[model samples]
Target: MLKILPAKEIYLQGNEHAVLLLHSFTSHTRDMKKVATSLHAQGYTCYAPLYRGHGHTPEQLLHYQVDDWWQDVVDAHQFLLNEGYQKISVIGLSIGGIFTLKLAQFEKLSQIIVLSVPIDKEPAQLKQRIIDYAYNYKTIEGKSASQISQEMEPFHHMALDAMSAFQQFIQATMQQLDRITVPIAIYYGERDDASYAQSAETIYQHVHSSTKQKRGFENAKHLMTLGRDQDEIIQEIIDFLE
Candidate 1:
């Protein structure tokens, strides 16, 4: 029998300060594991929740709305709060970044870190891309069909309705960006495959946070958390949180 891989939540209990790290769309908590580990090393409690419809199949994502994902963050935040964590921060990657920004609108967070978020997205085009991918089951942009299939084997196909939900989430998040008052930090790569560095720069310029910073890595790609500057990125995050 083949060994089945489990999709488990990542949690580390440490100090009173808690950090919630969120993964990308179609990704599980594993994507944020390294960040959680680094934070744990710094004596910060960390939690990475598996969003609804994630960690199982990609097709399951189609059944979930942007609101469902946002609720996951809310529940995770509440979990920390229930554990007596008063000072909480968040780090979100890709669609997770969008959820983080949306969370800022409703929560009094200590800080916010956005990684590879799309601030200049063309929603219709993105939706169409998702539709095309679902229709053809094509290879991903940077991966072969087998590689893509292996990576997404646990997940189901992407659906058009889910893409529409994502578009709505993007619009909603953009509208609330100016309301974010916490100290904000954005990380981006100059050659990010999903979003441009200008999106990070744009967020730094627009968010109402008086203490905001933007960092760009010339060699890093979209997945900065797992890239060449991973250590540097973690150190920067630790420093910012401290």
Candidate 2:
């Protein structure tokens, strides 16, 4: 376990094939450890990296946006490449998954598996935002606006201009999908809050990779790999990489 200031480095067990695990927005690398463990137990070295402002405090991520994340993924790539690993595979959860695909649009990777990616940033897509505005500082029962404050904690007071940049990122990448020639697999939960119900299907239809797929699990939430039967999801990833 290596905490490199901005990026926490947790090396999974195996030393053979390497896989990089990037976590979601408003989250640290803690959860990816589950997938990393499975991959490592199967003899693949795994790198679970924490982003610049994530997994630290909500304030850390408030100012940072999606571009910051893309850079981190590339930094992780350089780190892994420097470690002498070839034929790398990347697996990411939620926003991390989108970052993985963003990287795939340009970088060369053995394969990329994206879970719960935000293909679009519709207001309906983020339930948290709706809840925040609807309640308007009102304390909630199941969860309060303050409880959900982490959603905007890092960028709370800012202008939220980060979204426009993310829009550009999506617009640029979606048009250049054909440029991504690597094997890509996407996994999403049927009950994901970040996506419209048909997100997985939409990705399958629009993405340009010849080797791509979409699999949605019943009752799986946005954090599908961390939900029930998470191991089975990791197994699907293992099979994909194998």
Give the number of the best model, judged by TM-score.
Answer: 1
Taking all chains together, each candidate's TM-score versus the true structure is 0.84, 0.80
Best by lDDT: 1
> What's the true lDDT of residue 221 in model 1?
85
lDDT of 2 by residue, 1-242 (tens): 22334446687647757899988766677769788888888889899877776655334555566777788889988888898987789998877877777778777889999888776764233334423432342232235455655554533445535666766776566566667778888888877764534656666777777888788877788777789859789889999998
Clash counts for the predictions, in order: 6, 2
Model 2 lDDT, residue 218, Cα: 78
Q: What tens-digit string does per-residue lDDT give for candidate 1 at 1-242?
A: 22325478899999989999999766678879999998998899999999887765335555676678888889999999999999999999988898899899889999999999986455556555444444344342345666766656433444455556678778778877899999988998776864557778778877999999999878778777888888888888888887
Instruction: Tell me the whole-model lDDT of each prediction, alpha carbons only.
Output: 0.79, 0.72
RMSD of 1: 4.6
